[model samples]
Target: MDDDEVLLRGRVYGTDDGAPDSRPLPGRSYRELVGGPLDGLLLDVTGWDAGQLSGGAALMTELGRYGGGGRAHYGPRAGDPRCWDWAGDTP
Candidate 1:
């Protein structure tokens, strides 16, 4: 990825009730409860299983469509760089 690529990272922690709260602060327009870099998003849910990852990917894709950019999917890898190119083959 080029220097133009924006890299945003955040984490999600849940309470004993299994509800997510206290996400990373938004640095862009969209109210990202868990993620950022509002444009040209490259999400890596590789930590999750294939099914879970696919579900999150689909959700992100839908959200991206609404947000005006696009979404891509990637598989799990050791020390994968969180950048545009590192985002594996789309779908």
Candidate 2:
């Protein structure tokens, strides 16, 4: 967390599978999606949970799973000042 940085917070539920229940972290999303968060999500976890994320953070990934179809995850990725992906949303 810094002046030029932002943090999207979420609850990490460790699972017996060790893979956990989160997505966007593994699937084919994190590379493009996490970089798009503007980013959790470790793999297919681009959706919502009992958590909070920035506007850009909400824009990318499979947010469809969260915010009841992304009602809470709406906004422009370019306009949001906090909407930035440190990885530049690249693979």
Residue 75 CA displacement from its true place in model 1, Å: 2.4
lDDT of 2 by residue, 1-91 (tens): 4432233333121222334453224333222223333233232234534243443333333323342233223322455433334433221
Please tell me which predicted candidate would have the highest TM-score against the true structure.
1
TM-score of each: 0.25, 0.21
Error of 1 at 23 (Å): 3.1
Question: Global lDDT for candidate 1?
Answer: 0.32
- TM-score of model 1 relative to the true fold? 0.25
**Candidate 2 — worst ten consecutive residues by lDDT sum?**
9-18
